[model samples]
Target: MMRAADLPGVIPVFPLPGALLLPRARLPLHLFEPRYLAMLDDVLKTPHRLIGMVQPDPNPRAAQEDAPPPLHSIGCAGRVTQFSETEDGRYMITLAGISRFRVTEEVGGFCPYRRVKPSWEGFDRDLARSEKDTGFKRESFLDLLSRYFQAKSLDTDWETLKEADDEMLINSLSMLLSFDPEEKQALLEAPSLSTRRETLVTLIEYALRGGDDHGLLQ
Candidate 1:
C-alpha cells in the first residue's frame, strides 16, 4: 500500500506516445536510448526506484521544436520491479504500477531526462483495488477483441486471458491495444476503473466496425 506522502515530490518522466500505463498494471520497457538508459541508471541507485510514464503531446508543432515536447498532464508512476542488462548494452526492465498522478509542474535541471512535481492527492483511490465489478460488458468486449485480433492477424492465448481478473483483463487489453496517442491518454486519465472499461469497449467496437483509426486522435 502506497500513501500519498510516500510518493516523491519530484520524479523522472518518460514521455512516449501511444504507450499507456495504468495503476496496478505492468509495463515492460526496452531501454536502449541513451537518455532513458541514464534515467534508469539513476533510478536504480536511488531508494525509490520509481519512474513516471507519460505521453507526449500529439501536435505536430511540438515535435518540430528543439525543446522537449509537451506532455499530457496525467501519468502513472511505477516501481522498477525487474531489470536485466543485455549483452548489447540494452536494458530490459519491468515496471509495476503504483499510482496515477497529475503533473503540477516541470522542473528544469541539467539532467538529460525530464522531471516533474507530481500531485497524487486526487488520485489516492488508485492505491486501492479497483471495484470488483467494473460493470464492463465482458462478453461483448471479448467478442470485439476477438474480431479485432483476427482483423490484425494477432494471436493470443485465450486460456490465459480467461484466467485474468476483471481489473487485469481491462488494464491488459487497454495497454496491449494499438490505440492512437490521444486515445491512450484518455484511458490513462479516466476518472475511474469503470469509466476506463467503458472507454476501452467503445474503442474496440469502433475498431471492429472498420472505423478510420486516424479519426481517433481527433
Candidate 2:
C-alpha cells in the first residue's frame, strides 16, 4: 500500500561496493555486521521499512584508511519485504526494489549507519510495476548471454531465464552478475529498461573479449 510519496526524503544507505538493486527486483542480503544489524532494526520500525543500496567510490585511490569511502551519488531504495533472525544473532532480509534515488546529501545522525537525503526525481516510471521494452529481442539477447556464460563457465537455470519477463531478466542479471562496480553503476543509472539491457550486453561482451584485467566481477 506504499506510494512514492510514502517513501522518505532521507533513508539509510548500505554502501556495498558492487551490489545493485533495480526497480521491482528483489535483492537478498545477509546482515551480520553490527552497524547493519542496527540499521535493520531501525528500518523495521518505519512504515516504509526501506534501505538504500549504494556503491562506495568507484576509485579505490580516493578512499583513506579506516574512513568510509565516499559514496556514488545514485542508488536504489528498496522496501524490506522479508525478514528473519537466526539463533546466532544474524539477520536475513530481502529488499524489494521500489525506486532509484539520487543522494542529495548525507544526513548527520546519531545512528551508526549512514543516512542520506534521497531525491526521487526522474524515476516516476519505476513506481509503475510493469515497464515494457518492445524493442527487446529475447532470442538475440539470450544468444549473447549464453555466450557470456559459456565463456565464463557459469551455469544458470535456462528455464527460469526463459520464464521471467524482460525487466526481471535484465535487472536480475545486472544486479547478480560480477561485473566491476563501475559497470554495475552504469546499469543502475541506465535511464530505462532498454538502456539497462544494452549496457548489460556491452559489459558481458567486453568481459568475454577480455576487456580489462579488472575494468569491471564484477
Candidate 3:
C-alpha cells in the first residue's frame, strides 16, 4: 500500500502522442527517441514506477518543433511492468494503469521529459474497479461505432471490440476517435467510468450525425 504523500507524485512523465490509459488497463509502447529512452532507463532504476500519458496537440504545419507539446492537466499514472530492449536501441514496454492524476506543478529534470507533482488526495479505490456491463444498449452502441468507423475508413476489430472489457473498449475507442483536444481533455478529467461512458455515448451520437465538432467527443 502506498500513501499519497510518500509516493513521489512529482516525478518524470513521458507524453505519448496518441494514447490514453485508463485505470486497470495496460498500454504497450515502442520507445525509440533518445529522450524517451533515457526516461525509460531512469524509471526502471526506481521502485515507485509511474508515468503520465497524454497526446500532443497536432501541428501538421510546424517545420521544426522547438520543444515537446504542452500536456493536458489530467493524465493517468501507469506503472511499468514489462520492458525489453531491442537490438536497434529501442525500448518495448508495457504500462499498467494505476490512477488518474491531476498535475499540480511542472519541474525541469535531467531528462528531456517533463515532471509533475500530482494531487492524489481523496483517490478512491472503488472508482478504479467500477467497470460495469453496458446492458442492452451496448450492442446498439457498438453497431453505431462500427458504422462510424467504416464511414471514416478507420481500422478496428469488431470481434476484439466485442470481447474487450469495459475499460479497454471505452479507453481504446476514446484514444483512437478523431476527438478534439478539448473533448479529449474532458474525457481524461471525467471522474468515473460511468461519466466517461455517458460522454462517449454522446460523442458517438454526434459523430454518427456527420458532425465534426468539439462537443461531440468531449
- The TM-score values for the models, in the order shown, are 0.92, 0.93, 0.79
- Per-residue lDDT tens digits of candidate 1, residues 170-215? 8888898888888888788878778888888878888878877767
How many Å off is the CA of 203 in candidate 2? 0.7
Clashing pairs in 2: 178-217, 178-218, 179-217, 179-218, 180-216, 180-218
Error of 3 at 199 (Å): 1.4
Q: After superposition, which runs of candidate 1 have C-alpha atoms over 4 Å from their true positions?
A: 60-66
Task: Report model 2's TM-score to 2 decimal places.
Answer: 0.93
How close to the true structure is residue 184 of candidate 1, measured as C-alpha lDDT? 87
Highest TM-score against the true fold, candidate: 2
Residues 1-218 of candidate 2: C-alpha lDDT, one tens digit per residue: 45777989889999998889988999999999999999999999998899999998857776678867789889999999999999999999999999999999889858899999999988998898768788999999899999988988999999999999999999999998887788889999999999898888888888878877375534
Candidate 1 — what's its lDDT?
0.86
lDDT of 3 by residue, 1-218 (tens): 34454466576777765467777777888999887887887888888777777655454453246855666666777889899989989989998877777777667756576788877654565234546644536787788888888888887668898998776788777766777666776677767666787788787787778876754533
- Predictions: Cα RMSD each: 1.9, 2.2, 4.2
Candidate 2 RMSD to the correct structure: 2.2
Q: Write down the lDDT that model 2 would get.
A: 0.89
Which model is ahead, 1 or 3, in terms of TM-score?
Answer: 1
